[model samples]
Target: MEAAMSTPGRGLTWSLRGRGPADVPVVADPGPWPPDSGGPAATGRGVRVCVVDSGVERDHPAVGRVDGSWVVVKDPDTGETSVRPTETGDSCGHGTACAGIVRRTAPECELHSVRVLGERFSGTGDVLLAGLRWAVEQGFDLVNLSLSTTRDRFARELHELADQAYFARTVIVASAHNTPVESFPWRFASVISVGSHQEDDPGLHLYNPSPPVEFFAPGQNVPVPWLGGATIRTTGNSFATPYITGLCARLLSAHPSMTAFQLKNALYLSAANVRFRSLPSLPAGEASDESSESDEPGELHRSRESPEPPEPRLAAGADGTGN
Candidate 1:
């Protein structure tokens, strides 16, 4: 029997036991609820996604039609926070890169940008929380947070917000920190956490039989839009995260009322490595069979190497986690 572990809010997220690449085999059985990424099914027509990063460049061709823009403002004197509309663009190109990935994956999804990181990608932990709270309150279908806080003090607040997003059906797709260090939101079971994979196929993603980081997507040497409508190749878990976010948007667009948990299940079943024991049709707005869902994952096989540390940026650390 495969081993399983439970998480807060989310129960028995992983149903199998495997560590690293060799242990997780690729079974050919198609899962009961296979994730469909066919062209017509998921264009992200009706989904709303909030990119909470440095900020997204307006009309950068790659990231077209940003429906709204907001910034988290902190009172330098009182240290209070508020969210306001902004005409500003990306501060250090990170947010634009993430936003561009989402656009490429799900072209029709409504995109919104909220600037939590400023010039040189410098911002505080409180500011991160404020921006995240605002994004969650907006009821956005998905929030792509490529940044995180390493401070233990901020963990509880981030967890609460993650739970809030989970129960509200506002799925939060967060990136696992580039280093093996501890971080927020992404570590929370209530959120869909992602890490990077070394694969040429952008369409490929795999489920780990382990816990903590749930899925691995494309995040190495990715071609993405940068400042001034320029394109650059970058590598990091940050880039891989939007790949999952884009998928979530597409899934939600197809299944309009899918909760974060349900959407995550579809992602798991859709994973290239998942093997189906029996093909069971899932009712709309429900999870797959008995906690673990599909049988032990063993489908498509690929390189599962842990991504190296992200390339260094010129800025002062990422916005949020103090450098």
Candidate 2:
């Protein structure tokens, strides 16, 4: 567990320590639902999960319902909405893919789709900050940030906001960046950084293998509902983050009093560890068993390690596509 200290003019300073290399082991593909792995029905029945990304196809089969949503960006030159289903939707297909994962893991959770990135999947930090603030104001239990920027100043402010929200007990989950270089916001210690793994392709190793990845979710060529009533296979750290977010919703719904820190610890402790042949140096940790009650607050204690390093993998395909 990483703690944030105060830094002058830097908002909050996070000194990450204890995080050694990524030591979590890889497990056999658990074949969709792990046996007796209480499906979405066991968690997140009524929780509200706010996804701040490019916009979701609200009508997608996986997206059974949306509680609320809005467009946060528009083309400055054209004066047209940049979010989808109007003049906007997921042109890059990243946002839709992420939304699908969240819906898959938390079918009953109310989704609030906030379109901060435009159809082009590009937006300034101000747009993202505004979307985050709005989600906090709306009282969402979880905020999923599938996109991030390289801007340091914006990243600091976003971290501060996330810290404040976390103290308020709102869970914030971010994709461990996919870049070969570090990305902001996701690098912030206050956010639960997620990494990618291939459930079906066990041969495919995890992406951005790092200690910062608190939990791993399916990311390689996962099936997602696409625009125009189509289904496409995609892969990225962006898609992996939603699985964590959906799981957070489930945990939060089951234990309404669990703090953001506690929920994060539950995930790390619950993760099924497997040894990757490519990274033979890392040791395997024990995976959480069904007997363990992850929904309970204080089930797992925090660690003393400094926050893990920022995700080292960059988003695929587009430079600024929302996650």
Q: What lDDT would each prediction earn against the true structure? A: 0.79, 0.64
Residue-level lDDT of model 2, residues 1-323, one tens digit each, is 13343334454424435554464443421112222455323347778898888777767787767667676655567644333323345555667777888887776788878878654445457777777777776678899988877767787678778887878767788887786676767777778887787587421223233565566677878888777757898888888888778777766554455677666655543444421112122236866454445435444434323222111111110111111
**Alpha-carbon runs more than 4 Å astray in model 2:** 1-41, 74-91, 119-123, 199-210, 274-323
The candidate scoring highest on TM-score is 1
Worst 10 residues of 1 by lDDT: 314-323
For 1-323, candidate 1 gives per-residue lDDT tens digits of 11213333344325454566566664431212222423234568889999999999988999999999999888777988889999999988999999999999888899999999883333458889989999999999999999999888899989988988898889999999999899897999999999998998877888878969999999999999999999999999999999889888776655565667666776775676654454445779876766444444553233323221121111001111110
Query: Could you tell me how far off, in angstroms, the CA of residue 149 lies in candidate 1 after the best superposition?
Result: 0.4
lDDT of model 2 at position 58: 64
Score residue 317 of candidate 2 by CA lDDT. Answer: 7
The alpha-carbon RMSD values of the candidates against the true structure, listed in the order shown, are 13.8, 13.5
